[model samples]
Target: MAYQCDLGNNQTVYLDNSGSQTIVTTASGSPGQQQQSSNSFETGAWTAPPEMYRTPGGVTLKIQAQGGDRWIQIQGQSSNLSDASSIPLQEVSQVPGSSQQPMQPMQPMQPMQPMQPMQPMQPMQPMKMGNMEMNNNPMEMRMGNMEMRMGSSPQNTGSQRRFCSQCGSPVQPSDRFCGNCGHKLS
Candidate 1:
């Protein structure tokens, strides 16, 4: 004792009361005349299932046996009921305007360079004579505290000048060009 037969707008016709009596017939277009029939008195002008049924892209439908499930919503392209279990193998080739997605190309970028400038140098000459100033004999008055060494000392190797054997005169004390001219150049 269960009931539901709303072949109404969206359509839903499913019946199977435990055992016995079964009928299912649908018609929209000629569909090659007919595909299935079980006219048990052929009820109604037969024109429900459209309150919101649809097909063509988005589809929805259901029908189970043993008095249970039932539903159908179609908008176009009706195939009664039984697409051999809904066809979907990528809809089997149908290309009109071409569109499955895939395309890419774009690249252009290069420009950057600038830097050069360096040249200026000429100035050098200094070994000795930045106003020469140095004259402190006695090695600094004997360095570590005097010990008597009266000038005329440093001749370790230069300018002890005792000249004038005859006239080179540099004889230390007193005139005698004869020392320089004194004809004594020792």
Candidate 2:
């Protein structure tokens, strides 16, 4: 039998029973790293504390496991675990007050510039058909039980239009094959 519990942020603790023995494993992923710990013990009558588990980030697990033939093992730098994992890697290099001799003096900060507002784009006027100018409206027509939708084609040089035979979707003039339905434009 195997059981697993999440300690948050991809960290997990797992318990597995193998014959007469059981193995408990804990894995935690700190800000920039990952670490795992495991313990093995025989299944026997033993006493356990009210809280028996601890994660790498000092976030305590309220588990109780007392006495048994328990063998515990911890891996990775304990100092790293005690510290906040969220600390940026760039900050790790420079200590707060630690004075290391600098090769050069720091440069002065530059002044900020005022922001300019953007101008809105002008709307496009629709093309004229015959003597009447057509408004910017969607073209809609019907043929028997089918509804026909139309739009201006930039690629089509002539008034002729093409469609996909499989799905009956419009096909571009420049394209040799159907773009929508994948059917060959014959």
Candidate 3:
């Protein structure tokens, strides 16, 4: 069984009973600058009162045993062992034959399957403009008598092409009325 006593100002005392021997440890200071000291002795050593133990840093612990209970008092403070500032040390372990159960192990996870490849996209249908049809891939437009193909070819420079202002369809230079919508051309 193990017992602990907290003496405020970042200092604590621990007592562990290991059958024939008893271990006493004193720990002080903050987390990054901590200092600890421990001493072990026969369990019969604490059978009497006023037993003094000094730490490495010059702090002293005054231990007393009374009525089958052990009490601790820090030196340089108060000499009274039963005062309110004094703390009693006793066993802190769980009682025997408790109903608490142990934890179980976790199971392994299954592996994932790879994703299937995506299908290729289908080609789009040609769009219709007044009386013309336009193929978007190569940029070819066809109307009544004029057909315009836009690309790196020099035969279709697009300078001789004329379009109706109203219907936006290709028209010849000599035509007076648009063939697609019959709109008057200037």
Candidate 4:
């Protein structure tokens, strides 16, 4: 069966109900001048085109029903619509096997508090030294009261040679006297 309605400005809407699907079509002015659009909605798990109808003012209205998911959506399009006009009159989504609750309008949010000022940082004092000596080789560092040094362990040059303390002369390891000054090297 089909139902028909006149929409003032020479426009007519036709709704055809047959089988498990319903189709809605609109025609305006003369048959040849009609900017015709049609949509169909079905009752089963099968997919169908969304239902759309346009007013005489060129504003299009669309509706979609998902029979398997149990959700319905409605939207409108207009040339005068603003970019920020996004809040739908009604919206719904369903999660399979979960309970669903109706939606409520959101409340106005409270303003945030101002941030606190930061405290100034204290300056650090430089380290004091009585007498400090620094060397590049092995990097030796000495403070007046303390010493910090880094180097490898002392190594043996060769046979243990000795020096005569009285005349400052080189002495062999087994020498009993300085060979040049004859100083007794006990």
Best by lDDT: 3
TM-score of every model versus the real structure: 0.15, 0.24, 0.31, 0.25
Candidate 4 residue lDDT tens string, 48-81: 4333334333433333334442222222334433
Candidates ranked by lDDT: 3, 4, 2, 1
Q: After superposing candidate 2 on the true structure, give the runs of residues whose Cα lies further than 4 Å from its correct spot.
A: 44-186
How displaced is residue 132 in candidate 2, in Å?
Answer: 99
Each prediction's Cα RMSD? Answer: 35.5, 19.7, 17.2, 25.1
lDDT of 1 by residue, 1-186 (tens): 222233334333322222332233332324355332222321222222211233444344443434444444422445544332342211113122223444556667667666666664443332223433222343222222212234456454443334454433355534334433445322
For residue 108, what is the lDDT in candidate 4? 97
lDDT of each: 0.34, 0.49, 0.60, 0.50
lDDT of 3 by residue, 113-143 (tens): 9989998655468988789888755667777
Between 2 and 3, whose lDDT is larger?
3
Candidate 4 regions exceeding 4 Å error are 30-32, 44-186
Question: Which candidate number has the best TM-score?
Answer: 3
The 10 consecutive residues of candidate 4 with the worst lDDT sum are 87-96
Better of 1 and 3 by lDDT: 3
Give every collision pair in model 3. none
Report backbone clashes per prediction. 34, 5, 0, 0
